[model samples]
Target: MSASPLLDQLIEALRCLPGVGQKSAQRMAYHLLERDREGGVRLAARLAEAMEKIGHCERCRDFSEVPVCPLCASPARETQLLCVVETPADRLAIELATGYRGLYFVLQGRLSPLDGIGPRELGLDLLAARLAAGDVGELIIATNPTVEGEATAHYLAQLARQHGVRPSRLAHGLPLGGELEYIDRGTLAHAFGSRSEIPS
Candidate 1:
């Protein structure tokens, strides 16, 4: 049972997205062909356009349509405080928590030595330089509670000490190895409120 050439190609491409299996891709592909042909074209066009237009922020490496992201570019956001996390979604979680009013620096990914993601890959060197230049006051580590996340946080805390600055990791309560994106607002807020310094 083979799909038509065009349908098979569509299915293959869409399946590249996370959580989208062959069945889901086939369903979506048929839906696009039968009902949303123009809509599908528009979606593809918009995706391409956004990819071309958006780049990483100069300051925090968050996705940006401009050189700097909205939060980093805005003058009103607190410049002294910094929240470091693995992805933009993690940043969104802190925003949802509603307690952190400061700016953020997104690592885009966390350190995993087994996976070959190291300090240079995570941009800790860049962060160290930024803090040393007196660009921030306190660095709040909001990375997830997974093994790699904890490793990354510990590494950053140690790096900050060499620069004579202190770093703090979020307090326990996020469920061991849990991600920020899935946490509820109350729990996230409590984590932020009760954050403890990563011991030197």
Candidate 2:
């Protein structure tokens, strides 16, 4: 432990961040104290303010300072297409990588019974309500290609069908420009199974 109790507490606090171990936390604490005290103060203030003010968006459930996020508030976004993502990060990834102009419904997490994350935990009820409103024609399931994600996708598809909304999954297969030999067996198998005919 450090000589200063506050410093030790700071190191422990830094360790709370994802992938940050004891050594990394200690290093960060030392750097903040020695080299970047002003930066550290700014970081602390902003972090505190964010924790206090940032909340989930009412419509999309993404982190927002306001009730409805800017994207959901925008009238230009396609109301007929509602993309379902596992997290705000995933939504951001889609927004950055694709030309998708549709709205979103952030699940926050996939259905993991063992972890105590279920339909209610992921806000599926809210999504169901939105689907039932009949504005969304398509529910784009953009969950990750994991076992839990697949289960979550299946559940979402059922929910969409119940509401008469067409459900579509993000095509999972091979990455562009990647060689077949370098790809994993599961990916290769999936790609082969999902092979589509070349458009004339």
Candidate 3:
């Protein structure tokens, strides 16, 4: 009448993922153990690999396997133009959706004082140092349209001004309260293309 210990453990572990409830976790556990053992093994291997190898980029703070991410190391990317994003996923979405060839500064998270996340926690000090280094000419804030994201963008904009760099925010194509990672490619591209200057 009781499930095996390993099966129960797998189901519980799956529930740790966002939006996955107990029922969904049980279904996934059964699907993986019964119908797709090989796929399950591959997933386990990949997760282990990523967990062990992935670390934040020294310059951009995005997840990377090396000191710097490939995009940051690329000579083709414009060093003078920097895009600010809330997470590595958001940066990836913008890169895939837009014609942007600039460097990026991943905040790793946004301001959430209630949750105890602030400028120092998001590596804003490092960003300010980079801006003040004078290699960057512009900062494009591509944070999500959420309240926390907006506050983060505004704070970064102030930092940009203090460092004498131009500041801008993504345009209106992205819907209000929408996260950048969930937006469609076309809409993201339009928003990036029509980005407006933020007086700083």
Candidate 4:
């Protein structure tokens, strides 16, 4: 039997989340209704609040309520050292694993021509502008080891060279095709410690 209109809408809305299938959505909907209406209401309110308030940081492209993220606004961070990564989560992982004091540029995604995600889509123009300002002396690429990530890293390395900024890549201790967020802290620390310069 088809679900009631409200139930159907709730299930569909839940499915909008990544990796949440119909069954999972249905289960979540039911669980929320059955055991935790208060939590469900809070979740809905928080989602709405986040959607209304959270936006990409002007400088780093990471999620932030203000125009600039805390990292970009911080005075202690090394502004001359820049690290590029696929997402904000990767940046957080790096922060947790290593003592990297550099500033970061979050791509929000990697190069994927088939998906129509090119340089513009990944905010490379904004990054290019930052590099052209000549503040960044060295760029460290910490994108995942996936094929698309590799392509993005190479492209950014070229862009850095064009702006006279040295480019480096995280070491190979991170397995091929592995995401930075999933790597162990020890491996991530090692990778950051052993990062090598990309040949211009």
* Top-scoring candidate (lDDT): 2
Q: For candidate 1, what is the total of clashing residue pairs? A: 0
Worst 10-residue lDDT window for candidate 1 reads 1-10
**Compared with the true structure, what per-residue lDDT tens digits does model 3 show for residues 78-189?**
8999999998889989989999999999988899999999999999989988998899999999999888998998998999999999999976688889999999997899
Alpha-carbon shift of residue 15 in model 3 (angstroms): 1.3
lDDT of each: 0.86, 0.95, 0.92, 0.94
Cα lDDT for residue 65, candidate 3: 93
**Clash count for each candidate, listed in order shown:** 0, 0, 0, 0
Global fold similarity of model 2 (TM-score): 0.94
For every model shown, what is its TM-score relative to the native structure? 0.81, 0.94, 0.83, 0.80
| Alpha-carbon shift of residue 81 in model 1 (angstroms) | 0.4
Q: Give residue 145's lDDT in candidate 3 (0 to 100).
A: 81
Off by over 4 Å in 3: 1-3, 173-200
**lDDT (0-100) at residue 96 of candidate 4?**
99
Per-residue C-alpha lDDT of model 2 across residues 1-200, encoded as one tens digit per residue: 67999999999899889999999999999999999999999999999999999999999999999999999999999999999999999999999999999999999999999999989999988999999989999999999999999999999999999999999999879999999999999999999999999999
User: What shift in Å separates residue 154 of candidate 4 from its native position after superposition?
Assistant: 1.4
Instruction: Give the residue spans of candidate 1 off by over 4 A.
Output: 1-3, 174-200
Top candidate, metric TM-score: 2
Write down the lDDT that model 4 would get: 0.94
Write the residue-wise lDDT of candidate 4 on 69-162 in tens digits: 8889999999999999999899999999999998999999999999999999999999999999999999999999888998999999999999
lDDT of 4 at 58: 95
